[model samples]
Target chain A: MNNQIEIQLSAKRKEKPSFSDLKFGKTYTDHMFIMDYSREKGWYDPRIVPYQPITLDPAATIFHYGQTIFEGLKAYKNENEEVFLFRPEENFKRLNRSSVRLCIPEVDEDLALEALVKLVSIDRDWVPDVKGTSLYIRPFTISTEPNLDVTPSQKYRFMIIMSPVGAFYKEGMNPVKIAVESEYVRAVRGGTGNAKTAGNYAAAMLVQEKASAAGYSQVLWLDGKENKYIEEVGSMNVFFKINGEVVTPELSGSILEGITRKSVIELLKHWGVPVSERRISMEEVYEAHQNGQLEEAFGTGTAAVISPIGELFWNGEIISINDNKTGELSLKIYNTLTGIQIGKEDDPFGWRVKVE
Target chain B: MNNQIEIQLSAKRKEKPSFSDLKFGKTYTDHMFIMDYSREKGWYDPRIVPYQPITLDPAATIFHYGQTIFEGLKAYKNENEEVFLFRPEENFKRLNRSSVRLCIPEVDEDLALEALVKLVSIDRDWVPDVKGTSLYIRPFTISTEPNLDVTPSQKYRFMIIMSPVGAFYKEGMNPVKIAVESEYVRAVRGGTGNAKTAGNYAAAMLVQEKASAAGYSQVLWLDGKENKYIEEVGSMNVFFKINGEVVTPELSGSILEGITRKSVIELLKHWGVPVSERRISMEEVYEAHQNGQLEEAFGTGTAAVISPIGELFWNGEIISINDNKTGELSLKIYNTLTGIQIGKEDDPFGWRVKVE
Candidate 1:
């Protein structure tokens, strides 16, 4: 196969739908980019086809064993009508990391970057210009082996699907209350928790329900051994502010290394805000809260740049942070990230990867 | 459903194929049992339909998030044409336990047991009369809501699918070599490790591949916190013999409480084999190997009653057990399990539930 990508556009296109007529992930664009791989043939059949349902055997490995991994990024439309990806190379790196853990073959970095550019360039109109909206790009790989035994699939498919999504904070970006889940574990050490696999997301549903039932927005997962130290929030990486110093949980074997978490650290360091990636125990957080030293708590992810956590419930006790309001470091870092993402400020760190 | 199951059976009858043509999970019978639950409608629409493809949106939770769980059991055929399930009620109890953790609605125990019996009766021809072969049953539930956000699915479908399976061991039960996975953790504390979900299976694939690459059969998972204590072998629960006593990992949050493991324990107890479930640390196992106290090790699962572990690769060292041969206890357990399953002896505990 040649290094060049061939553009075969979809003949059938859907009537353009308004961004308002869409939900988070319920609506999709007219086209999708797909590529296949096998041992006999490396990578083949790269095309942009009309978005349609994928036909899988009832016994496909993905359905039975959950051999799947995915990535979430966005194509932002700047005022100058340019489609840009915020540090797409980071997503590419993370995608391969996830692939290695799921036993799926990794894609060529050059080829994957080219495919992302081609997909976004052809579907540029899907990039919504709403303040908090963007063209959400989902790149995923699934094991398509037609076997019943629990083993890694020999064949896989990498696909890029685009969906126009609105503000993550549908009502408003109010501080969220969370329940600290001490009983269940989403991922353990020597597990695939760091990998953005479908299993990790699926495994979190029960704990998420428990959090909601406890009248909290999400659950803060503790370490797998003792369930005492804060690990992560699954979808997002967590951070805490104590006496104006930023402290996030040190990446144990199970916590996901989020792209947003990385960017937040760099941004805070660049802005000269005190930061530390050390072990942050729940007991310490509670003690700091009681001593009026815990000033802020927020979660960072692709969907939400920064979501402030106002109240937290642990061991049948509830504690509030920042007077139940978003914090100073959070607002500053959020401004910096979105500014660099939307081409409104200088990309000192060269985090923005322009598609066109 | 009525107090008595009003089964709507499919008229289509599948011709029985030769027992030699049995595959692991490919072929299925004519009818499958199904029951559904809704917020308004609680556990309605009990029917037996011809095996068919389930039509679902591409964005369904099962396809993306992997919110799926399944239980595996088998029906064995005896010489006198009697069919029995090896402790099927245990499977039902475990299934509901998994459902509670996944937040999926649970079916009535009596109704579920009845449905299992009815389904097995309808497909009794698939059960092989061979000593080691039987018809495998897979009862699974999946979240079917077509949405992309991170929340529990409201709609779910409970289904039972049966497939004719060959023997796990063709000629005789052979010992297997295992690769000790030090890098990955399958399940963690305070997570869904206890639940039988797709994520846990998917999480073990990478390690499984690694073990297979190194000419090993399975990977031994370590505790997520320390990666030292023995947890499980992913699909099968592991057992170790030290000083002539059998010790398996305690039912910690991360280990799957396998039906075969429980049954073997019961069978051994009845036969006066000392057995205990406690936290067996890897340090103890390794030290015992050096002390010549570690005699034999094996794993138990639905597919295989007892698979002996011939060797283990841990920390760049290979420890051989039983001289790469099947142990006495392993063969005894396998014979007992297969005997009880095939109804060759008196089932004192009434573990065998009659299918036909």
Candidate 2:
């Protein structure tokens, strides 16, 4: 664990059962890690304080300009009740990348990881061991500069908040039906689409609701330019299976490079699966489906280990895949990743970093 | 003005301001008008209370997803010390347009206008009489469903806050240089380009800062498809003076249909100036400049009445308009528009709505 987060416990810490009846983001631990950064102060005043409300000026940049970036990783309890973070360093690195794009201050990668590990360790009991559950850690930094001008904040607040999450999928790994949102585009090139900033999600909300109202669980966003190339499936990165070849969209300037997407690629490669990252257009996918060449599709993200996409309705044209069920490859990947995370199997990639 | 707003002031009011030293958004007037909406209670609790901190659940949809929309207008004190709102009806109409796009509930237009007028009346001294100054009115609504789901919020909050704003443009509107961002695309077809939502502004912030850092005042965005067809100029709509004919890019799905753009078109048409809206590409504009057929270029918006384009730098190419000054036609349009706003000229188009 990063030793940087020195705790100052809240006088209001719950006495008992705080560890048992926990739901994601509903209950918080006693303390939250905070750090301040400014051009004058550099990075100073790192403290773990009582979880409380932060009184921000009404003109704070975060309120007006949305200059915020966040990272989500989890601390898991293993079979032996030992706690470990799955690739904590990766979250920090990705957060910094998001920071650079949003013009927010980047963090010292090592210190961020340490803070997350320490905070999770302090609330280790909050990490549920009842299979496929963990303690969700939110490392977010907001532009705290109180100004009306739309510039990057000179001063900022970096915070880490922990929440106890139950099963991420709730119903386990189940196949989902998504809509091809040809009428709406999520992001465009040279935009904040690649960054984990708040605006990208905001831009997608309107169409996402439309898709959901049309009776779909998620949305498959195509490239904004031609509305053809597959970009993202709602919040997750997508993969398609065609004739036993696993194909996913290459990370372009407009697509987020998801950590789960990366892990899946590496694991598939290690297992000698024919995986390729290329630009797969909508027409090709539709034509393949029509010809019965399409096997399956799924999405990958932190909240969802793997969500199978069973069907797609593209611009009023519907296409159903084989069985409308979770594919074999996705099921295997989900199990293997979950196994490594819960200490049920040896992590050959050394992905888990154990917290003391 | 919309007359649908119901006001219930709190038992407090800030003392009158001297009105001279007021900075934009620094001092909020007393008695802010607010309303809430949900599926059950379509809209309720329309009240005007003392300006105070709003108590929001930490998981408010606006905090997590940027499902917020806002409008910027101003109340001007005419010579008789009477407050007047310039085309507030347009803002109310536009606000609903933005709300629909962001999947937020719409407010009654009459109610919105009435509430604004009453609030401005309560804080009349905040309306600055100084040239190029007025009491800035920010009417905004945010979704507060307080959930992590990416669906449209079941509940929404609509509020109006007023602050005295000096001249919006720091430099008196002589002209400004803008960088042509071929690399970054602002909005694509079926995107949130036409809406005055928070996400669009957040998406534009980094690019704007980059252009400023690169020594330009603003950015000129291109279509996301080919990066060729000129869209809006950052936040405002663009117009060109070519061979004595006023020209603007046609409102493709990506271009924001600016109110000022329509006003300018109507004003130009009234004065017998030939105007045409068509697809104008960057290559064509540059070619016109090279052939000396491009006379001038300027931008139009609520805040920036008219900003002349002095220089455009696009991918190592710098194109300069003649004389690096505001064009003649631009000055006429600015003067005509402001004259109508400040009640200095004839109200030919019935644009100004008196605050009752």
Candidate 3:
């Protein structure tokens, strides 16, 4: 399909938000990318129009059946005015995998990447040149058919929206407190956990809210079956450093395959640090802490590259890691990943793709 | 809060679809009920207006986080042209339970029920008067806040839309073939399986589509943990008659509390049938079938009052139930439930609520 994307620029541009006061996903760029899919025509008519509200029938499957998938990546601007994206191809690839799990149609990854580059190029001014801010790109697909049947939709819409987000953490890379959830489970094996879909996040909200009310920043979920194996923390993949070795939960079909998690593992291996991807249970962490071997723990995701764990509360027991301060290794990983993302470090892994 | 619902009738009535060719949820009535919820005002501004499309920001929480819940019920028109709702209060009650699980705010059940009845009364003309037809009512709530955060939304919209649906089975109450799913599990014990939310349905689509492709009407899901116990079939609750006794899966935290399932149990008990709700593993089911003790199987839901399962395919083996015919008990339950719904039988259970 020789599908050339059509561009329709906005007639009047709106005032952009100040980068200093930018909040995540609260502001949008001048233009957005959209494409439609149908069982009869597949995906067609790719277009970039002004960012605006989307009108849908109240009975659209997205609202009633939650047939949606999304990917989050950012376009970074350096002091040299050059824009770069961090491993965006992987996001589109993962999006297609999510589509298969939700029974949505697979998208053309190459075409989707082309569309992303074109969209960023069209809205280049929105990319922030500040120290820690970047233009967050969100590409999502939703079932648009107005059918109430509990079946795969026959029509869909794929869209890309941009938001200039400030630093994830207001202060420097500080550690956060997270509570271990015992009553609620986010996802399980043979479920939609591996897919970057909406339901998984929805299922975790109540637990997160309760944890937040108790003065914790996030909730750490345990496995659904035994409720002993650690899965993930909030929406991020987690890692723990015990006795001079780093270990994270393996991709056990119930945890998200985060891009940041993959990059962190790759970076650790490149640096020759001992890193293992295996099942690290909460009991093991507690025992490591008791033995004074649990040195540091942190979470990895696109939002916060490395969120240090200051404290963890599990079953009425509290374990403080690294004296409730950021660990040296956590700080190093955060700086390295961010440096590579902003073009300050050498591109040894070829993870960055230029927008121009 | 003294809330009097305001009504704004549609100026131009839509051309009603022919009752003989009506489809489920395809065509909607002229009007709909809508209410808004905000952190400060709670649920307010209850009103009924012309059915129309809803406009939302592309980053609305409902589209990204799947923060939505819905209920399905029917309004029947008896021979006297009186409209009746079958336990709609129960739907609103269940909606609140689903909202709690998804972290959305709870709505007032009494006010929502009043709104439903008022909306039905205004659209009473749209209710089909055919023998097996009724107005399918869909009451749903969605997060309307334009935010990309994984937290619960501060704003929400509750709506009710009605559709004239024809008989679920076009040709008599013919039995259907169902394949037991082994690869994809729908919901887990501690997950959002019990909630009538969008994610659960979305997760079941892939397996359902595969089963349909293999000449089955639905896919029967197994327990997510063990994959040995029966969970549900498609979107409905399942029941099996074994050794001259009626049994359904007990209300585990993972299975939906289906109103139709409750009604079936009530009717069975009222008639002095030996009914039990407990864990029934697939191994036991296969053994029963082998011993010729599996007498009948069926599913219960609002869409289909009682869907008889004529054939079951599990682990490369197929067993024809009641010689691939609708069981006598299945037919009896269907007729009794439909009779009560249409006011053809005595309302001893007080299941029906008059709309006018």
The positional error of residue A288 in candidate 3, measured at the CA in angstroms, is: 1.6
| lDDT of model 1, residue A100 | 88
- Measured on C-alpha atoms, candidate 2 has an lDDT of 0.80
TM-score for each predicted model, relative to the true structure: 0.91, 0.93, 0.98
Overall lDDT per candidate, in order of appearance:
0.81, 0.80, 0.93
Q: Write the per-residue lDDT of candidate 2 for residues A1-356, one digit (tens) a residue.
A: 23355678767665433444445566656667889888887777777786666665445566666777788788889778988888888899999998888888788888887777777777676677777778777788877775555567798888887767777666666788899887788888877788887778878887888777888988999988888899999999999999899999998878888888999999999999999999999898998898888998999988877888888988778788777888888889999988888788789999988888
lDDT of 3 by residue, A1-356 (tens): 44899999999988999988888888899999999999999999999999999999998999889999999999999999999999999999999999999999988998999999999999999998878899999999999999887888999999999999998876787799999998889998999999999999999998888899999999999988789899999999999999989999999999999999999999999999999999888999999999999999999999998999999999999999999999999999999999999999988999999989
Q: Give the per-residue lDDT digits (tens) of candidate 1, residues B40-131.
A: 77677777777766666556667668777778899989889899998888888988988887777787877778888988897787788866
Cα error, residue B224 of model 3, in Å, equals: 1.3
In candidate 2, position A179 carries an lDDT of 90
Candidate 3 residue B81 Cα shift, in angstroms, is 2.1
TM-score ranking, best first: 3, 2, 1
Which residues of candidate 1, in runs, are more than 4 Å off? A1-22, A78-81, A169-172, A316-318, A353-356, B1-18, B21-23, B26-44, B287-295, B315-324
Candidate 2, residue B354: the lDDT equals 76
Which regions of candidate 2 are displaced past 4 Å? A1-6, A14-31, A169-172, A315-317, B1-24, B168-172
Winning candidate number (TM-score) = 3
Candidate 2's docking class is acceptable
